[model samples]
Target: MAQEPLLRCSGMDKSFAGVPALRDVHMSVAAGEVRALIGQNGAGKSTLIKVLTGVYRRDAGQVEFAGNPVDFTSTQDAQRNGLATIYQEVNLVPYRSVAENICIGRARRRFGLIDWKAVNAEARERLAALDVHVDVTRPLVEYPIATQQMTAIARALSFDAKLVIMDEPTSSLAEREVATLLDVIRRLRDEGVAIVFVSHRLDELYAVCDTITVLRDGRTVADSPISELSRYDLVSTMLGRELTESERRGQHVGATATAAAPTVLEARDLRRAPVLNGSSVTLRRGEVVGLAGLLGSGRSETARALFGADPVTDGEIHRDGEPVRFASPQEAIRARIGFNSEDRKGEGIIPDLSVRENITLALLPRLLRRGIVDRGRQQEIVDRFIRRLDIKLAGPDQKISELSGGNQQKVLLARWLCTDPEVLILDEPTRGIDVGAKQEIQNLVRELADDGLSVLLISSELEELITDCDRVVVLRDGATVAELEGEDISEKSMLHAMAEGTAATGSRQPSGSREEDEVHD
Candidate 1:
């Protein structure tokens, strides 16, 4: 006998503020199948998932879960109906114990009271299956971010779920932990649990997914078996670009410099207590250096420490071959250093301000005349950057919040570039933007490097770093784990060194050039 599909959705239509996010989308998954929902940022994957999960009431669609029609008005209702979702940011209580988080509201009962021992035992048993055997009674916040996410995964899967939706599940997990996660996903698939996996990592999707669904510009473009599509085809479909393999490889058509290039900035033994420990890096003039690591791996911390946005308890920093120590961002700026934070909404944008205002926000001091502001110079700077970066907007006076995510990021980049910085530290510059925007940013970064600007690039997508960077410094648990350059910067070798809890260790050599050092973490 044929088994009914665990979940199905047909003609799903969703919109926000009159903008169509999902257009007549149809998707389905049978029991025991792993389906991948993939697309560039802003491609409506999250919107469709939300519609299916009842996080948003669908404008038009038919959704069936576990052989029953459902219009889930709430996530709780969806969970009760055997549909569970695990988001990238864990939705667990930080102060609660891991066991409590996993078994809460579904606790074992005895004589009208919760069975504490049974609850802990069940939670432990489930987490143990995923190879995470932490102290179940300890507060969830006590563990690292990766461990907490694993706990959240265990809790979601333990909800008697017939259909599970994992949104960027491995974003916070290290490569080794990512391997364990794939094993758990395979076990669930074999056990007939329908899984909807959403991730940007193409390598991972090809490895674990049975079916592929590609979305572009808020429309369903392709839906087929994973075997029917190549990695190139999938990316091309998502991007609508017929880029050659070399172009896709990001071989960097930007600046070229020999080993004769000078060192613009260097950090050695960087220590910011619990977050950054003994991390070292060198930024050569006219080069892009990628900082590679999983979540909580000190990638962002290293950027912040180098930029003096965070306190550096111990480290020797040199700028232009001269010893220096930055007390704050002001000092870093004085030294011609720029930083673009990952949290764009909070740290980068001033929502109510116009595009022109946001771009010139950092240049206020330079644009002053006799203790008063100079709007003319500010507007001139804004016009140059907007035109140069090809920022799409109605006008410079338009509210920054009204622009797309990509444009907002460009505004932030312009803000730093206006300072004429010698070195730029970008943390997740391409994150949450569409592929077109991502490509533009990459090209711009390379162009700047070619013009003798040094860049410290951080991105979760290994391909982005591999394509754009001259050297990559791998971090693990708040320390430098490996340094790869030239032929050593392949995805396979990176995943090996980024493997969690391994003896991976390496450092940048004295010449500040990539070729000299080799280590395995």
Candidate 2:
């Protein structure tokens, strides 16, 4: 007879604010296996992990562990049951020593007093067993983020955890650090531990996971062996699209265009202490220039500094051959520069406002006369963009939050476009949206550039950057490491520049290395 699975969850259902985040999702993990949970943003991947780790209670589901039903009312209860979760943010006390952080609740003790010496020694030994080295005596914050992440993993393994749930564990890790984590995962799997790995990095999922489960719109779309799937097929399944030649052709429509115009925006020696080095790049009219790099590579920081969302300590910004300094986003806007922030919910949109209101937000002054908005003119402009962008909404009066992520993004694009800006800076524009919406957004970007608008595109998806950009500027360790254009924008080229930081530019190499560099870069 076959052995029962180590963990099995059936009919898991969860909702947030009347919206079903996870619906009847079924998943199972066998001992000594690594399973990947993947989907677009808002596809319920995070929700499933939260439910599994008791971060959120499922509205409906049956959780069976080791062939027996179980109920966990809290994360502590779940951890006590041999289940542990390591979040992307690394949820451990940074001020505490590594040993204390790892074995806080179950510290070694003697006669009701903490055994500090034994705890530190044991913690160091445990980490060494996992092939991770760290100074257990020092505070956790003293080490790099990658080391902190490994400590979290070591702590989970120390629990004798039957199943370990990793939620984007490599999100902030460097290429080398990722390899270490992957090695640790393999060791744990060989030792009969089940792992559920959640990540947006398709390549990492293929590397570490033996089986794949894809979620879409709160439902399980497929659960199959990784060997039975191709990357394109996996992306299509997660995106709810049928595999076809036309769809693939339309995936990267912006890359074919070449820039043949004067520069719209240029940054010379842009620098911010500790984060952004003396980096420089130029954006020309009717072209999409991509800022490519891993997290903390100064891509977002450059955008912020250029848009005056953040102060710059050094460097100069030139518009049409003249130096310009923006003291605030308002100044940037007035100068015809628009920035679409990466954090949509937190920074991009006003959820309580209506779609019409949000779409015309940047142009409210234009619609105002004597401190009063012209409702008819506002409605006209909103209606035009709503139709032009194919923004799916019940009506103009619908709340911005009520729309899908794709529609919210379209609203944001309209919010800036209505202002008639010359330059648009989009950070992760297609993030967390469905496949259809992603293509539409990409095509819209191409159309916008063709219509003479300069764009600065920053995305973690390297494929998106390569295909949508007229030229790619690679950054590493807060500096411009390499710039690729025309024939040099292939995936291999970008990967090389990002990984080695030696792309014919003779730039300084990155000092720290981690796994996330591979995925994000």
Candidate 3:
């Protein structure tokens, strides 16, 4: 008879505070197979991992491991039962020796005292099996991040783990290190160990995963062998739509005829150390410019540099055709440049504060008189913005945390709009919100731009950029590859420019362009 599969989970369900995170998700893995778990942010990938690892309790479902049903109450129990995990951040003690990190929990004992020599020898042998040769006696911190990750894998195997769950293990590793880690994973798989790989990098997933599973909004949408899916299909599956001609039409939302408009802000060789390499962008009076590129392509860096959040050490910046230097964000704001950060939960909102307080944060100095807050004026301005933005909330005094993701974002936008800045930079503004909220925000952006607001929109969604921006500046490896304008705004062309890392300045107007006069898609 065939041997039973190593791990299987059927009808798994989990929720937090009545919000369903995972719904009837079914998954399985053989002894030596590599399974990829992928989804957008807040799509229940993390919750699924936690349920499997006992970091969370399942509200309903069944999880079977090694031919028997299991419900682990703690992570330690799960680890002891042969399921091991390695997180993006290595969890080993920094001061401990490499050998200790590997065999610290499973050390050989002698004479009622832990034996160090045997542990080091065992660690050395374990690493040697994976073709890693490192001094096991040295402190873990002294070694590079790649070596530390290898040590973590060794530790997991030391438990004789049947399944290894690697959660973004190479998120912070250098390219060379990533290659080495992939080799190690292959080696482990050859030894009959099942692996669960979770990451946002599609290239890496295609490289290592044998089977791919995609999750969308807490449901398992697609599960198939890697060979069956192309990169475009994978992206479409994850995003929940194929780009048809219907979706392409009426996508452009920003100003189309801005040829006569003058530049409001200009970046001449904007640079912030190694992240940005003499990148230049121009913001006109009534147009939206999209910053397009893959992850780590310096999209956010460009925004930060423009807003003076990051120091512009080697660039010339001008506002309203006049050259100026802004050493801090305050100076940028004073010069009428506003920025809405990508990390809304971390940098955009203070959860403990109320809606009114968060909305009026940037307008404080203007609303202050004799070192006192002008409550009536503050109320008038806050009420006006709240109504204008249609921010859904219990009351102006409601805790900002009580509001949904979209409302919190609206509050941030209000904070900037109240300032009446000449230019606004929005980075991933609709990332984790619902579909309704995303559309609302998109409409609002178009309305604002029509009223002569200069916007710099940075989003991972190509359609969003193509739909909203009059032009897109493609960046690759910290440098500008191409600038698409007029009829040149299309995903095919942008991907070409990004993949080639070269400028495609052809006048090929896409079929969907509102105007047939120009070419560029």
Candidate 4:
């Protein structure tokens, strides 16, 4: 007799504000199997997860658990039914001890008094079963993000959950931490637990997932065993493209720099406690330097330090052979340094502002005369970038939130470009955007570099970074591990750096090795 699926969904449909977020989506998970749910941003992956977890109700669909039809009215209802979800950002009380975090609402008690000793002991046992060692008595925030993630997993497993849904679990983990997580996941699968893993890291997906379910524009495009799909094919399916070898190779015509360009910006021993540790790199005129690493590898931290978005506790930044200090983003801007943050919605864009207002935001002072707005000058700059970047919107007057993700990103780029910056620090520039838009942005980046603008590009897409960057700097645990230039930049090399935490031959020497690296907790 064939065993039934642990969880299954059919004809699932969901919408928000009349916008179809998901349609006719189907997914199934079997006991002891690891399934990966993957898609580009806004492809309805999150929506499907929310629907499955009862965070959002489905307009139409059938959910079955162990051959029994079920409808969960709330997340608690789903939890009660043996389904558990761990978000990308672990949600737990920071002040609470790890034991309390793991068994908060369901703590064991005697005479209605919570048993703290018993709770910690049980929590310790659960973590031990997962091959994780941690001090359960300490506050959850006392551990590194990776350890906290493991604690969350321990909590879910302790609940006797038959199925676990992890969304971007490794997004904030280091290389060693990611390995620990992969091991924990495998152990869970061996114990007959079903897992749904969601992540943007293709390497991580291929490493741990047994099967893959691809969603595109809110629809299930394909579902199959991992061995049945190639990386190129999977990407094409997710992107809805008939990409050629050249396209897959990312060979777009754009700016290519030579080795002799003068270095415009340099960082020596850049440090931010608990995130970046003595990370340093340099950007030259007409060059695109890429920061490559897994999540929590300090890629964003380095960018922040360089752009003065975060305070640099240690290290020195020199521009044009002169020491420069940027106390804030405003000071950085005054020095012709521009930064496009990774969190576009939260940090990059102002939703209520018009396109024109956002684009000319950084250049307002230059466009102002005697404290009055120079409307004509602002319009001219906005119009130029809008056309040049091919930003699609009603007009410069359109609200930024009304535009698509790609267009919103373009507006952000325009925002920085209007500053006429000598150095541009772009973090995850193409994230949450469409394929065509991503390519366009890449081409624009190349074009700008060709026009003598120095750029520091940070992206999680290894292939994109390898192809577009003139040189690639790989970071591990907040420090530069390798610098690949010319022929050294390849997907294989980058993967090796991320996996083995080793510097490549001829690559720039990292400050230290994995063993010498300090653990945050």
Supply the TM-score for candidate 4: 0.71
Better of 1 and 4 by TM-score: 4
For residues 1-521, what per-residue lDDT tens digits would candidate 3 score against the true structure?
04476888889899888989999998888788888988876778888888999999999999999999999888789989999989879999999999989987678999978898899899999999878899999999999888888899989988989999998887667667778888888878888999999876555677788987888889898888877877656666766655554434134544556757989988877765446765777889888889987666678988888787887668788899999877789999998888999999999999999999999998899999999999999999899999999999999999999999999999999999999987999999998899999999998988888889899999988889878888888775456667887666776667655544554558232222222111232
User: What is the C-alpha local distance difference test score of each model?
Assistant: 0.82, 0.83, 0.82, 0.84
lDDT of 2: 0.83
lDDT of 4 by residue, 1-521 (tens): 03578999999999889999999999899999999998876789889988888888899999998789988878788888889999999988899999999999999898899988899999999989878788999999888898899889988877789999999888777667888899889988988999999986666777899999999889999999977887646656765655343322334233243477788899887877557766879888888989987656788988888877888888899988789878888988988999999999999999999999999988988887999899998899999999989999998999999999999999999999988999999999998899999999998999898888999999977778877888888887577777777666776566556544565565555554445532211
- Give per-residue lDDT, candidate 4, residue 402: 99
> Which 10-residue window of candidate 4 scores lowest in summed lDDT?
246-255
lDDT of 1 by residue, 1-521 (tens): 05677888889888889999999898889989999998766789999988888889999979987788889998888888888999988999999999999988888999999998999999999999778888899999999877887788788888778888999877767667778889889998888888999976665787899998998878889999988886546655766544344322346544245346889998887876556656788889888999986555688988888888888888789999999888899899988999999999999999999999899887888899999889888888999999999999999999999999999999999999999999999999999899999999999998898888999999978788889998888775566767777666766545554543222234323232222123221
* C-alpha lDDT of candidate 1 relative to the true structure: 0.82
For candidate 3, report its TM-score. Answer: 0.80
lDDT value, residue 120 of candidate 1: 90
In Å, residue 133's CA in model 1 sits off its true spot by 3.4
Which pairs, if any, clash in model 1? 255-450, 504-521, 505-521
- Candidate 2 residue 152 Cα shift, in angstroms, is 0.7
Model 4 global lDDT (CA atoms, 0 to 1): 0.84
> What tens digits encode model 2's per-residue C-alpha lDDT throughout 124-149?
99889887777898999999988999
RMSD from true fold, candidate 1: 7.5
Model 1 segments more than 4 A misplaced: 1-4, 110-112, 129-131, 244-331, 340-344, 352-420, 424-521
